[model samples]
Every structure is written in structure tokens, then in C-alpha cells.
Target: MNAPALKSKCLPTYLVIDTSSSMKSHESLLNDTVDHVFDVVGNSPRVAEFAHVSIITFNTDAHVVLELSDIETVENLPTITCQGTTNYGKMFQLVKQRIDADISGLTHDGRRAVLRPAVFILTDGEPMDKDWATQFNALTDASWRRRPHIISYGFGTANATVLGKIATKAAYLATDVDKEKEAIVSMLTSLLNTLVASASAQEFRIPDDVPGYTRVPIEFVD
Candidate 1:
């Protein structure tokens, strides 16, 4: 008789970046930091084995820069171009669609057991679409079993109130406008650290603190 296969635990992690025109100034830095992050994870055998990563970018439209995959398998990292307006509705809709497809694919044939996904969003400005919240609500519907835990990072002119509303797990805002480079580095570093720790702990782990940023309080209505 053949032995039964053991399912490996998987974490679907998404990095959702805002590539609006305002972020053009930091485009090169953003691309470099993202590529560095991938390189670090790809080299770490344990983290790479546990966390499957995807990259999503949003501007006038949302794009899947990288599909969820083993970090080591990604050959070429795409260059992120900053243009167009920040459309939150499009971003949220695309994230929801990708999550549905990703979760299903991960669990196919019971080869892997997926945990709740984690979404890390970095934005430099307020959303241009007025009805973005509607799309957000649909993506984060309480009834939906696959809804991800969202963590938002805001810098430049990003609205704190909006970041608070968008984050299901936590929100952060950069403290110094003069140190934009440092802030970006800190955010990406924290993300990499979170994945490394989570893989070691065998579960999802949020960073306790992020330098150059302040945690935003999330508002809840009864």
C-alpha cells in the first residue's frame, strides 16, 4: 500500500504598491528595494519554502507585476513605472480577484494547506476614486472566508484616515518628509523581517515596530 502524502502549510503574501505619477521621483528606489527583497527571500531556504509572494501595482489601473510563486523560481523582476492617477477601486477589485484565484490554486488536490493571506500596501497619495470604499468592503467582506489581513503604509500626501480605514491588521505613516528614502527602506525591510519571522514561527507574524513611521489607529464603528 502507498503512504498518504502530507500537506505543506503555505502563506500567500502580496505586496501591493501604488505607482501613481506622484511616486515617479522614487521609482528607481522602489524598484531596487523590491528586487532586493526578492533576492533576500529567494536565498533564504526556509522563508522561500513557506511564503509564496506576489507583487501587485495600482495607478490608473491595477497590474499583476508578479504572480504568486516560489521566490527562487522568479527569473526576472519587472520594472515598476509610475504614471497615471491613484485608483483605489481598481486596486481593490484586482486584489480580491487575485486572492480568490491564488487560494484556489494553492489548495488544489490538497497538496498544500493555505493560511489567511497577508497584503502589504504602500501608497504615496490619497485615492482619486470616491467609491473606493465600496470595492474595499467587498474585498474585505466579513462573510468571506478568504479575506486577507491588510497592512497599509502611507507616505508623502497619503491620507491617514484612509490608511486607517484600509488596514484590517495595522496602518503606518511616515514621520519625516525629508527622509523619504529612509522611510521606504524601513517599510520594505520590515516586510522582509515579517516574512522571515513568520516562517520560523510557522504562522503569520506582524512587526512589533517600524522605524521612521508611526502606527495609525484604526477606527471601528458599532
Candidate 2:
């Protein structure tokens, strides 16, 4: 008897990067890190088979540099450049809208299952927008499904309080590494590996802890 082919499930992953003026000095390093991370994920059978990756860049505004595409089909990933002030509010709003649209597309396009997406926010500075908190709160409201587990990575002048609030699962401070750029790259690589392994095993949630990454404490808001 011929066995039926199992339906392929899709796990959407978003990389939200800060391209504000503060990151200008390390822009090249950031590009290299992104390239390497994508290479590792794109080459992995587990990730390539199930992961749909997207890229979003935020500064004065937030925009999707790359829409959701399967790892195997994605090529020529874009490079980020430092620009205007960081507007976390704009970023959060765009992310919320994108998630809604992406999920709908996945459901309609024949994916057997579309797991809760994972969002990785990497930044080196604080938000210049006053309404960032409000936006973040709305984006992560309890009513949302699985809420796209957010993992924040902050360094350089980034505020811990902001990162913690934005992270739904855990926020990490990428310090302690010998070199700042190297540490950032290493942290990103680790994230990619963890994401691929978990999604391959059909686990979509981000872990609360990762080796060598310092956890940031979340702050309570009234």
C-alpha cells in the first residue's frame, strides 16, 4: 500500500534590525553577521524545509525589507544601513500588520500548519518615539494567538528596560564577548541554530535561556 505524504508545515521567522545612525560604525559587521546567519539556516535541511524567513528594518520608520519566503527559495538577502532615529512604535505597528497578513497568506496558500512566528529584534539604541511602549503593548496583547514569541538582543546604547518590555519570552544583553561585533555575530548565529532545531522538531516557542547570553530582567509597567 502506498503511504500518504505528510503535509509540510511552515514556521515563519522574522528578523527585525535597527538601522539607525547609532549602528553606522558596525554596519559592515552587521551585514556579515546577517549573511552568515542566513547561509547557515538556508543550508540546513530542517530549516530549509520548514522555515519562512522575513527581514524588517527600522529607524525613522519600519518597513519589511524582505517578505516571508522559504529558506530554500531566499537568495540575496539585503544589507542594512544606518539611518534616522529609532522609532520602536513604528516598528511594532508594522510587525503587527505583517504578522496578520503573513498568517493569512500561509493559511490560504496550502501550508498544513503555520506555527506561531518567532521574531528576533536586534538593536543598539533606544527608541526615539514616545509611544513605543503603547505600541508594543498592543502588539503583544493577550488576545493575539501565540503572539509571535519575541526575543530581543540589545547592546551598545540600547536600554535594557525597553528590550525587556519588547521581549515576550526573554531579552538578552550581548555583552561579555571579547569583541562587540564578534559577540553580536555569535549571538545571531546561536539564535539561528536554536530556531532551526526547534522548528524542525515542531517546537515554535523561543527558549528562556541560551548559553553565553546574559538574560535581561523584564520591567513591570502600570
Candidate 3:
């Protein structure tokens, strides 16, 4: 007898996360930002269907934190604690690896080739480790660069100059860095909502290359 066919389903996927500390005074909201994303994706049809998600977190160290999975179980999204300093180089590398690993599984699962994963990187502080530039270039190598859309959003007065460079061409400053948690949540909703829509798609269209305005709109300059 033949074995049952594995359920074949398309997956709209992306990475959403917070960057290093911003405005040391308000650094405690990083986990809230991640939780807000989970709540948004968990509740939305745009992201809940076949759209899977992964999370990466960085502060003094970088980590994959979460793996790609359906939003149904997304409530288990880990708490992102704030400690140490920023390590942009390590964080970018972690992101690259996560995507690369998932690509293999997607190919074998009879799933369609993916749209460039949308990466929403929200940060309020700078990388404590300066090797970030070299790491950024390596991760931005043509392969990874072409495969994912990285958007850098700064909150609580994060340095726009820095966020701009990380996001490449697409970057924005949050409306309120002091109250960055709510701002990050709104940004996460737009990103996940779009990703959910993308997953439900038959063919991957480069999603709107623009950042949808959020609860508190920030001046986006790239």
C-alpha cells in the first residue's frame, strides 16, 4: 500500500524581530514588541493560513530564537529579554542561516518557491559590536540580498542613519521612540498582514516595496 500523501500547502513566510537596544532608558519593551507581532499574526487571516514565521533576536548575542511554523502555535513565541549590547554582525548571519535552512524544506515539501522573505528589523539602539559592517556585507551578498526584503524600522529615536544602512534602501524611524512598544506592534501588524496575504497567493509577487503606515507613523527615509 502506498503511504498517505503529505499535505501539500503553500507557505507565506517571513522574519519579524527587534534589533538591539534603543534609548537605553526604554530598553525594556523588546519582548513586548515580539509579543505584539505574535498576537497580530495569530489573529489575522492574512498571516494565519499557510503563512509561517520565524524569529531572530539579538542584543549582546544573536539567536534564531524561533523556527518557521504555522501561526496556530505562534503563541509560544519566546520572550526576548534585553541584556548585554548589540551584535548586528551575528544577528544578520543568524537570519541568513534560518532562511537558508527553510529553503530546503520548502523545496522538498512540494511548495512553491518563496517570495523574498520580508524582514522587519526594529531597533532603538546601536550595535555594541562593531564588526556589524562586515557581517552585513556578507549577508547582503547577492544571494541572500535577492532572497529577502529587509526593512529596518527605528524606534525611540534610533539613529536613522544606522537603520537605513541595515535595511539597505528601505528604512523608517518610528513615530515615538519613547513609546516604542506600541509603535513596533503596529509595524509588525503591517508586515505580518502582508506576509499572510502573500502566503495565500498562487504566485509570489514582490510585495508592496513600501512600508504601510502604522498606528504611529514614522518618517521613512531611505
Residue 197 alpha-carbon offset, candidate 3, angstroms: 4.4
lDDT of 1 by residue, 10-119 (tens): 89999999999999999999999999999999999899988999999999999999999889899999999999999999999999999999999888735456989999
Ranked candidates (TM-score, high to low): 1, 2, 3
The TM-scores of all predictions, comma-separated, are 0.95, 0.90, 0.74
Q: How many residue pairs clash in each candidate?
A: 0, 0, 6
Stretches of model 2 off by over 4 angstroms after superposition: 1-6, 205-212, 219-222
Q: What is candidate 2's lDDT per residue for 1-222, written digit by digit as tens?
A: 975554588888888989998888888998888888878887887776778888899999998988988767876977678889988999989988999999898887877888888888988888888878887877788788846878888887778887888887778886676666865786687678767777668876555565556889865321
TM-score, predicted candidate 2 vs. hidden true structure? 0.90
CA error at residue 157 for candidate 2, angstroms: 1.3
Ranked by TM-score, the better of candidates 2 and 3 is 2
- Model 1 weakest lDDT span, ten residues long: 213-222
Measured with C-alpha atoms, the lDDT of residue 181 in candidate 1 is 79
Best by lDDT: 1
* Residue 150 C-alpha lDDT in model 1: 92
Model 3, 9-94: lDDT tens per residue? 54535454544444344445556655666777678755565566777777777877778776777656665655566668778877
